[model samples]
Target: MSNIVSVFAQKCADYDEKNVQSAIDSLFAQMGGVAAVVPQNAKVFVKVNLVREMSPEKCGTTHPEVAVAVCKRLLTVTPNVTVGDSCAGMYNKGMLASVYAKCGMTAIEDRTAARLNQNFETGVADVNGKVLGKCEFTSAFLDADVVVNVTKLKTHSFTGYSGAVKNLFGLIPGMVKVEMHSRFPDLTAFCDLLCDVCEFARPKTVLNVIDAVWGMEGDGPTNGKPKFIGHLLASADPYALDAVAVSLFGDPRSMPVLQAAMKRGLLQDDLANIRFDFERWKAKRIDNFDAPPIDHTDFFGNQLAWINRLAKKHMVKRVHPDKTCRGCGKCAMHCPAKAITLVKRKAKVDQRKCIHCYCCQELCPFDAVRFRTSLLYKLARRFSGKRSKNT
Candidate 1:
């Protein structure tokens, strides 16, 4: 219930057999005792950021060691601790098994009383929001007595940034998430959909944790370079935790999802409103953090269709299926807009239909999807950069 977003300095390497058991103790202690937050013998679901099936060292998913540490602590308070996530792709036992094994989440089950979630059932739930009325939700999470949001800090291509709130997006069943993207193509609306999902799940989410020991920098939630931030953050308020996380690399308000959160009064625009050691956390900020190069404007939010098209054609980034594509249909299969197709055994994108959601880039397994910035947009950015420097 505290607005305090606790920032703790801890390294990924520090999560070893010698210290892994108590790795995140200080983080929880700073907010309040870990025991005080979790209910006794409750069905606790530790929903983690398993965006796709990838190795943990890639920094695309939550680190197994960090998940294990949290699971160990939670098991002390609850016998029904489950660590899992509905990763991108199909929602089935086989997909879950593959993702858990590849992401090293299976280690959590091997080491502690916490068991991997085997349930893949999903059902409709009343979202009852401005954009989302009702949507599919993973029953494993919806039925939980308490939910612990364990997310990775990263720069997202579509959302601008990914943190605790965006992490909850995994609760929506796997491939059905692509449909949500199609349903809300506008970034503002998609972000609103995100807010709706979080607001619906907020009552059960007691703790929000971010694994910042190694965070993805560019074109992320998938492909990106791992940057060592050497910190772990936690708060009962997912919005406040995200605000602090976004400040590590850029202005929190600049993120479309965070902007939407503010619009709904779920978060405040001012960072000072949140409780924390401001001086200490500020000193830890990564001044040169590399964010995705795409324009973050919500052109789709514009009412005039022609104006939206014109702006999108000149200012937005374009997705290209490069030579490394291997003629794979992965991008086409997951593209929310269905803008991609197989041509001459290679993937090609229809710019007219493309929604710029970056689902193609995020879900492509071959790492073949690439982005190109518009010439006019580049020139405009150069001019803006010069003006800012002169001022």
Candidate 2:
């Protein structure tokens, strides 16, 4: 296999615009530039992770500055660049447009005369052979000749770390995300399904760029603290890019998505072959990034071979909520699964059906629904904690 990764870290120079752009230009030029990856006549689709309505300043979404810079550079090769994303909740094309405008991308469009598109088409990837059913995706992603994935580096509660691979999961449009969560209720199973989707969607993506200038710590993808890393990463291999990213800020062992990718042999666990100059772009390493407490050995450790089968049989039921859910469901829609329903201008869930997917908790705008488990589960958590301490 070809050594497909290169990293450049020039601390003092990176702060200089001439130096930074030159570095970026050199990297892209080495990787065959936009022309090599994106054909001159091809329609280039820039897929960004605009998961929530948070402004670029929040670090919940990809920074506009990064997107604009890349777009400006790409325009040197091609003008058919379209920036789009399937945002969560309501489709606010204007909101995204505003972000791009703030990031100076809109000026590039005005100056260079390009087009910006939003997610429109509905597509699906079959995951029938895996732990979950087929996942529905936006059509814009499926039809593009050149797909560039731009993701922000952040911590995720469920998957451990959110980077390029996890960002693509947002391609699943609208309420379909909730349905997929319901299918793979557990973390390991869900991560497997995510990797399956990545494998299926691999051909559609040509390049991956991670915005590491400023990232989120603690709870993220949303609801996390912002940590500035002052780094930007790019690669043809999403797995390698993510591997490097996780190493910079978080533990590899704790990331379900990374672990799952390793288990499937989709990525190399060792970073020895990857080529990057750490001295130029390396940020002051952050410590004590918080993530969910999960012992993979206890969860899927022993029967790694049988996780797919075991998940299908014993995976806990989880609850999911859509943007429309205001945490209020009419009495007629009130559900005990803690699966949210609208009742009398209020939203509630059927706690009985909740599988602990934390979907409702994640998507709830009002933060109404939360994980509510039995006392036994709580005690189990305490015992597991004490055991870890003693060990």
Candidate 3:
């Protein structure tokens, strides 16, 4: 028999601490309280999704209210509580200060006794991972007795879904995350690395909470419109938490992160094994969730090289630099394919070199990287719209 994982959900229309506190407390209580995961005087760390230093309205980073709610409950178990995230920046006094200030993390310290993590020092853990044998992580992550992964529920361009599993990528500190994307450009390889990190941390991570109150749609993780989801989801098992979260849309197979986890035997697409009130959650399911278009895979590329290139060019969506490009050169710096370059003081992407991973699109702070579909691909989608909705 598969493990009976329990997940709970509470509708939160806003991020008000008073409104969210009771919901947070009730879900934890229903799931056996924080004591189930944290021991007395244990060091508890809350990992918030601070992808970049953006305002709360952007709905990119985990709201400060979520951190406050988690810390409020965590305090009952242990006084040594810390909340932080490894966003896309240098891990220094300047970087941490900017991210905390912009993303409202400093307020967490003021509201609760929990403090922000100041440790920039990283240590390597021998995961004996399938992809990379070793991984580098912040001391806060490795030293924490119990880690509560609080992630912003959003649509991702590459991974298809960014929930508990996608949130684990933050463990790989700083620009090194960009390096990993460059190393594993393919979604399958990249998700394997994510799963490896998730499996390594799964034992220590006590709980996973997803902030779906305001999830991003379209080009998410950074540049996307915020949609009011009104859901506060949690589970002791991160995979199960993710499994339930991804099912809100059309099909679990549409999301590569969930698909990859299923392929690795890390999780199942269905919640049959997960112990949750499926009937209650049905009422709250998002009917018209606007997820990004899925980039179809070229499985038969090996047969013919020229035909594969032609297929990719006309089929897969391409990332383009729009007028918003500030010539910051940030996109060029981290692009795995080395396809982008500054032209006439504006960033440009060489479609041929691009791999359609959307790393540049996700990492770009300016929302300058826009996705463009080929005319033939657009026509195909028009005709097949009814046949394949999520795809």
- What TM-score do all the candidates reach, one by one? 0.92, 0.76, 0.92
lDDT of 3 by residue, 1-391 (tens): 3477888888787987788898888788887878886787889878899988799889888888888998988899899998888887566678889889999988888988999999888899997878877878888899998889999888887776788988988977977787787788777788888888888998888889999889887778788889898888998888888877876765666566666677776665565668888777677778778787666544244675664456556777788889979999888887877899999879999887887768777777788888877776666555545222353
Clashing pairs in 3: none
**What's the lDDT of the predicted structure labeled candidate 1?**
0.81
| Candidate 2, superposed: residue stretches over 4 Å from native | 1-4, 7-23, 29-32, 90-112, 125-135, 277-284, 292-300, 303-338, 342-349, 365-391
- Weakest 10 consecutive residues of candidate 2 by summed lDDT: 328-337
lDDT of 2 by residue, 1-391 (tens): 4344654332222324455466567657777676776667667778777765566676777776566666767777777778777655434466556545544445445644456665566867675645656667777777777788888888765676778888777767745666676667667788887887777667777788888777877656566777777777788777778877777755554567877877776665665556765443235555555544442324333655465344333333233343455533421132223355565556655655555555444444353443323444334446534221101
lDDT of each: 0.81, 0.62, 0.80
| Number of backbone-clashing residue pairs for each candidate, in the order shown | 0, 35, 0
Q: Kindly provide the TM-score of model 2 when superposed on the true structure, using C-alpha atoms.
A: 0.76
TM-score winner between candidates 2 and 3:
3
